[model samples]
Target: MNGAPQVQRRRGFIMGFGAGAVAALGVAALIAAIAGDFSGSNLTSQASQVIRDEYFKPVKSSVLNDASVNGIIRELRKRYDDRFSHYLNPHQLRQFESLTSGRFSGVGLTVTGVKRGLRVASVLPRTPAQGAGIKEGDLITAVDGRSLAGVPTEVATARIKGPPWTPIELRLVSGSGGATRNIRLKRASVAVPVAVGEIKRAGTSKVAYVSYATFSQGAHGELSSTLERLDRHGAQGLVLDLRGNGGGLLNEAVLSASLFLAKGQLVVSTDSRTMGHRDYDAIGNPLSQHPTVVLINHDTASAAEILASALEDHHLATIVGTRSFGKGTFQEVIHLAAGGALDLTVGQYFTANGISLANKGIKPDVRAVDDPKTPQDEALRRALAVLAEKMAVENR
Candidate 1:
């Protein structure tokens, strides 16, 4: 379990979890059978059965099951000091799958939770939300007839997303102290852009500007193709932006680093208590040799940090912006026998130079911070400036 095969096996496991309650029960029975004594070793399951039979009030089995699994995760976190490990219910698992797959059925708006409701961050083009005239800065106070006040953004988002062609209503307030207006729209399948690219002029140097929202499925391919296209279009330098990316598939991160790095170069190494040590290396030819600068901020984490650290350690790119969000740990989503999954922290990852980014994030070579109140992207400007300097040096 130390190469591409291992990575593929991990990905396959995540995508191939058996469906339905029967599959769950079958796995649970197997575990109990392996223990050879269900009554003693499987106390949690027995307790659940007892609660279903003897509880004073009525309770849904699904609710009880979710609670039991979550309680286990909570105890594990406290006992093992693993803050990142948690359980995802079936609905949450579906959302996670959709997010990593880069598609979801929704009205097509990105929102963050606020005290009163959800704040519309950005509206995707050609989507139902945009068609209905929802704009950035709009406050969504309710979904359908239910008030979204005090609701977490994830929960509110789940409520908004449903089967394609389904109708949904939102009550919105435009700007602060604005009157609320209800808007109704139909949900549609929205393809989230994992990687986006363009060419921007930095001084006389045309730089390929690439931004990754996440290292989801097909992200490396998307980034590779975009960089190739931009290189062909006469981009003299590159600005790789990973400002708010949280990360996704680990293989995607390895493959993405392979895009810029020479074949067989080390990308990252992980040390797991169970999986042991494994090394991931660049596997493909370099996309372009253009002078590069990488942009990172407080939100750049996990796989993004891995890529940035690789390039920085190899002296292939100049890192710009503030320190990245340190997240050196990697998690494995293990499908439970009773539905849902346990996203357990399985290992710690090291950068190309063998540095652990836990708590101590990647420091920018040219630190620049962007003020949210301002319209200008100061950090991006600094990135472009760094790219221009590198291009100048390369041309000399």
Candidate 2:
């Protein structure tokens, strides 16, 4: 998990134990099951009493706002016991939806809460982010005059995504060069820019390139289709360019990696005390049987890590990149006593091979330092070099 609680590198948030683990309904039900009078409002009444007596009365904490209450519950659970909790507010709900399903109109960039304020982790090249002159070391202090200090990451995102062509101004404090400037960008669909291709050289070797510009729901379909086409095109070599990819859906990561793995191999799994342990696997033979390579950088994270780890674990491909954003943790989404939901960290994850690429990203067998203006990839070069060596030995 490169961004704990991130999946567009967005919807990636925190989760907690099961609903039963967090909810009073279970308490109410259990109480009623024993008392034999479990009913609607009565459950709520008893639930409130139980919660009030257990938490509020003890600490004299009186919170009504759903978001605040949820945050407190989560804080308590994470700090103290393993009790389950969640957060639900209008902005939080909207942000959650946008992260998971809401398409935004803006350049895809990863911003995080760091010691030096909000720092830009990486910028997808040639997108609005690059167009706006947004660099990797910029610090986002405010958006539209809203100081991002103490703001939830999701809330910061909702502000970032707006109507296309509508200028959004970002106030920043630079990380390096000690230069501060306001970066303005117009939001647009961060899809279509990413491309996947398979290259076949008669006298040389086959090549497959999956150029990722940003994370999108369409990314999985596109990547899968590209793999299919490469297989059809008789590709013997593969190259996955995650140079600018900011990451996406958690499940998709598993799906993409599974495509190149043997059947019955586990891909990913979650570890939450309340949320029953779950695991994923390759449903079928993923490879048309081609050697592969994955390219990543400081920007690659979350779902990206998931895919990279799977292929590497299975020895299906070699990972080549500078280093990856280390983010690993699972969040639970709980239905609120209100109407919305809660995004809280409930578990952590591991590759089927049992390696947790959480804080430590997948290390390349061959490391390559990315030179932005160079336009040539050293990772691909090393990957090609390795694949060639293997192919040469096979031919002999």
RMSD of each: 14.0, 13.1
Clashes of each: 0, 23
- Residue-level lDDT tens digits of model 1 in 155-180: 56677877789999999998545878
Which regions in candidate 2 have their CA more than 4 angstroms from the true location?
1-88, 98-104, 108-127, 172-178, 192-195, 198-203, 212-218, 231-234, 244-246, 339-341, 373-380, 393-395
Q: What local distance difference test score does each model get? A: 0.80, 0.66
Per-residue alpha-carbon lDDT of candidate 2 for residues 169-253, written as tens digits (9 for 90 to 100) = 8887765566677877787666445555757442387666667555565666677777778767667667777764656677767
lDDT score, candidate 1, position 131:
98
* Residue 119 CA displacement from its true place in model 2, Å: 4.7
* Candidate 1 least-lDDT 10 residues: 2-11
Candidate 2 is scored at a TM of 0.70
